[model samples]
Target: MSEVERPARGVSDLGELLATMRPELDPDAWVFATAAEPLAGAEVTVVEAEGVTSVLRKHDLPTAGDAPARMRVSPPFARITLQVHSDLEAVGLTAAVATALAAEGIPANVVAGFFHDHIFVPWPRASDALASVRALQRDAARAGDARG
Candidate 1:
């Protein structure tokens, strides 16, 4: 018999998923730089040189620093980055991850880049959070198999 192709699985059982996924540690919590400067410091990269005034006035960015430089935003959550080969934007991936985390009572913030998707969750719940995400992946795989 020829093996059937399967449709990819999406997140389903959150509890079981969290139990299986290994938690990872995130180094930096908050990264800040000038709007004009290159994105550096943390995993999340910020580009475009908008002045601090512009960020504050237009984007409602917190004015903690005095200088104007390119800003990259990543609120530290116990974060895990998945290398998704699919052409999904950061916001879409974030929404998917957030949906899974929410089911487990884990709050998450997502930062997207060109290569991978980054998820930030509360430091305390990092392990549980990672497990939750991994579970989602497994569930997706299972669903894909079922379709095939």
Candidate 2:
């Protein structure tokens, strides 16, 4: 008997999904599409496109030789990842997360990856955002998606 390929699981339940996904925030401040590509002496790099990169590094000034082209490193942000295998075709995860954060007056800049969705919000408000997201999960698990 030929073994059939197991399909990737995609969650459509807003409440159940969020309830289990352990979202986390990065401690270091990260830059958004500003650093020069192929940067040396960096801690983390998110993306490299169009000769620029969004990098996460220690809170230290860059050397003149490695300075970013244009940086707006203010109101430092934190990265939160939904630890779940999310389907790209799946609808409403992004909207739901954003909406929940918005309800707490926390702005969310979402980036959807193959296996997960990421939200970047103000650094100081990261805890607040995390709490809000967790609460959303609880509400969803209890209410089964009130967004209908």
Candidate 3:
């Protein structure tokens, strides 16, 4: 059996990349922070930042004003990952993705990591955002295939 090409990479063709990579949203809510290290067990975003040490825990993590981590996003945030290996400098990907979400009145916080683009939409509207993203992927695929 031939292996299935989930997300065709190296195309760099924004349209094709968006079409092939079916972005999936995680069920558990997530958050971001400039953590010196990864949260002990929580699946969170931790990056190297020059400052006092910190950790990326869920919103439930105790914090207060004057705390190194002043901001605490409650109700958490929904995380979605586009499985395409888009280059860091890739143009139009983030814009297009954000535009789609915005059109549906869904706010998206995009985080461009090494392998894929992570989107954090409001937890309440996460399902709607996922639907919008899936629709965009389907439409892009249809358009790309039709051009052939």
Using all chains and alpha carbons, the TM-scores for the candidates as numbered come to: 0.53, 0.70, 0.71
- Superior candidate under lDDT, 1 versus 3: 3
State each model's CA lDDT, in order.
0.52, 0.71, 0.72
Taking all chains together, the TM-score of candidate 3 against the true structure is 0.71
Model 1 gets an lDDT of 0.52
Best by lDDT: 3
Question: In order, what is each prediction's RMSD in angstroms?
Answer: 10.4, 5.1, 6.8
lDDT of 3: 0.72
Candidate 3 residue-wise lDDT at 30: 65
Ten residues in sequence with the least summed lDDT for candidate 3:
48-57
Ten-residue region with minimum lDDT total, candidate 1 = 51-60
- Candidate 1 C-alpha error for residue 36, in Å: 11
lDDT of 3 by residue, 1-148 (tens): 9997654444467887788877888877665544444334444454445522222336545455434443433456788889888877678888988999999999888877667888988888998998988988999999999997
How do the candidates rank by lDDT, highest first?
A: 3, 2, 1
Candidate 3's C-alpha runs over 4 A off are 1-11, 32-71
Cα displacement (angstroms), candidate 2, residue 95, comes to 0.6
